[model samples]
Target: MGPTLDSSYEDWVRVAEGVVPPGRHRVGGREEDGAGAVFAVVSPRDGSTLASVADAGEKEVDLAVAAARWAFDSGPWPRLAPAERGRVLLRIADLVEEHRSEIAALISLENGKPIAESYGIELRAVAGTFRWYGQLADKVCDEAPHTDPGALALVTREPAGVVGAVVPWNFPLTLAAWKIAPALAAGCAVVLKPSELTPLSALLLGRLVDEAMEEAGVPGGVLNVVAGDGPTAGRALGLHPDVDVLAFTGSTAVGRHYLRYSADSNLKRVWLELGGKSPNIVLPDAPDLDAAAATAAWGIFFNQGEMCTAPSRLLVHSSVAERVTDAVIQRAEALRVGDPLDPATEMGALAGAARLDAVRGHIDAARAAGARLRTGGAPLDPAPVPGGTYLRPTVFDRVTPDMAVAREEIFGPVLSVLTFDTVEEAVALANDTEYGLAAGLWTGDLSTAHTVSRALRAGTVWVNCYEEGDLTVPFGGYKQSGNGRDKSAHALEKYTELKTTWIQL
Candidate 1:
């Protein structure tokens, strides 16, 4: 019998300590790799040693890549009809929903997210992504451009061969699905490298994909999950000439590295979904101050504020800054930070120990830089549940643009409040960041919303709301936030190439 999705905190704790074996490299049809050293995966919840996971080093990376290459060149996956490919993807979505609770528990165990969030956000998105792309598969039609009467011109989209996808630890399965679903739907093979900190869930996903493909009369090697860190497995995939396209979701620095790797290798098409320092501007005439204030608190504290699209900087109009700031402080202080396995928990641990320390450093630096710490600037006292890497929800008011806390992507439950005198300054401050990933605006006037949204540099602008969108609209960023888009039918463009055919009669 398979290990169940443990219900109680005690049952989950048992699984965390090893009721289920840790994930491994799922290469080709093989589930084990003996080529590289094993790394210990630690649970930030209670500081227990989760398990030792086998690494996917250079040789293992090569093996996975080779499998993907072979699958693309000669396997039945690429050769199948578009509708058939879509059926496989649909099957994957069904399989994901069937095992939702188990996967959610596994993710919370490794990623240190609350179980409710794990189930609601990551798992929910994962299944939806597959379903959306699967439905879009056959709907994508080739184009026949108008030309001279005697001649015809045709444009058709084709799979771009093998893809190398690397996802970060923040939202493991959701981000992985953002890259994986579209590629598979487009008939492209992928070698997915999930962050070492959160590889277990991805490995589990790979197993389900294999099972889905087999049931759909497709080959099993269409996708591979290699568990390794950035330097080895990621770099290998980036520099490999065999990969036709590389899609990554991580830091801007790593995004730059992939571009360099592309230049150094066969000039593979590289698409990145990088870092963000998104702003949430609450104007004096906000449609509802209480609602905006609540969203601000939720935006900065959800998932322990590990979201790439998180509203990290709260820019308030000077007139309402104090009231809004005070309201947010009260909400932040009220958030329950405790055991992730516990149902009452509203917040969870940082991804791991290193992240906890780095967040503390950022908070300390903000203190030295003269930003007023209105609430929480240190680790939770007496340790919530003992040894868990839990930081108190932090808020900094009177923050200037130059402050590191205001400019940097802290990737934690840290919020910086800056006051803006006019709409011009608010727009300027929102557009000031090098990242153009996402931003939030709250205003009562529709014209201001329209004009300011157009003026802001972010790819996604949430008016009167934050972190809200569906798969129908494309999700991506501008400037240093990386290239290409994820979600929607536009995502297929990254994995498929267009070919032009000219005919003369």
Candidate 2:
């Protein structure tokens, strides 16, 4: 059911030797030398250096963009039939499934997610994304508009030239797939920049892409990857004049920067999926209180609360606040924070030391700002998992709407509880923050559920659930959480531009 994280370094070394090439960047369908600046890929689990990877500078980014541009303009990729492109994407999906174990291992080891989650959720999503987009490739068609009897009008969707995709560290492979699969399926060339913190899995994906392209007779220079920090590679890709579109999933701060980059440069199309402080509302209804409590715990504690759509703010009806808070505290305290590689571990380390320090700062700030510490505020001892960046799952009660903990995105295993007396107050409290990414409400009244779901400002709202959805549904955010959708047919629109052609008979 889950992968065993007990695999030795020697075991991973063998796999890495095969999956990751000497140079991480794949340009023009081959591995190429990166910039001389090399950075260590440090593991958050025990703070070990897994490997050193080349950091892509402006020069490397230029090369990648050029390759993508050439692929889009003169290469065979865009010229291929939509059905043929679909077949190639299907082949890529097959290869990803074949190497699922290795990809999952790399993700857990590099990003500090539980091995079980890496295998069960992340890897599976990666494969499924390609398949979904593959199936959709041929389905998209041009429209023949109703026109005058003597005239004909046609509207078509064409691939936007080079697509520059920059994905964050959390859920690296799955998020990358969200951008890459659709871009390629739309017959666009891609130059992907994976976060430096978790480049291993993306680089491994490059191998699969290369193999699949060769097998499917797809041309070289269609897919390129450059691993580096956001400032260099990310900025270069954003500001590059030839790049027709940019897709990014990261912090709101960086998302704004890309918008500025587009304006200052060629005004390329920019799609962003950014930060969130999503709220979870528990109402006094006919549903079981125990189940609501468990769901509340899962909303915040899952993935160590490092999710952009994490339900960090829990709003419970005053009548059941104490009961639900108690249940959530019990569940938080019971979570096991240890080795990510261990199959039994429910929670793992933060991505790195920087993230660990950031989470601790938020915890201290919340306590000082008058939030009551309910359970598990202290960091875990390092004795069991030496050198690992482990933090305790924390829950704070008696939190007010204006408190810093409730307002800001801590992005850790920190949950803040607020009690509301009326539905209007609950909606106000939920929308108090700048984020509108997601929200969850648990209630037995069908009318109340529907009413609150519509009233919430978030892009995605769940009734009696949290973070439940599939590729078929569109996922994105509203307000400061950022712009544009990630999954579904809506995502394809971001990779392609619409054109109209009119003819007189």
Largest lDDT belongs to which candidate?
1
lDDT of 2 by residue, 372-481 (tens): 99887777875236888888999999899888999999989999999999999999999998989999998999999989999999999988888899999999999989
lDDT over C-alpha atoms for residue 149 of model 2? 89
lDDT computed for candidate 2: 0.88
List candidate 2 segments past 4 Å from native. 1-23
> Which 10-residue span in candidate 2 carries the lowest summed lDDT?
1-10
Q: Can you write out model 1's per-residue Cα lDDT over 11-56, one digit (the tens) per residue?
A: 6555445547455788886687657588887878778777788888
- List of clashing residue pairs for candidate 1: none
Q: Pick the candidate with the highest TM-score.
A: 1
Model 2: C-alpha RMSD to truth? 2.2
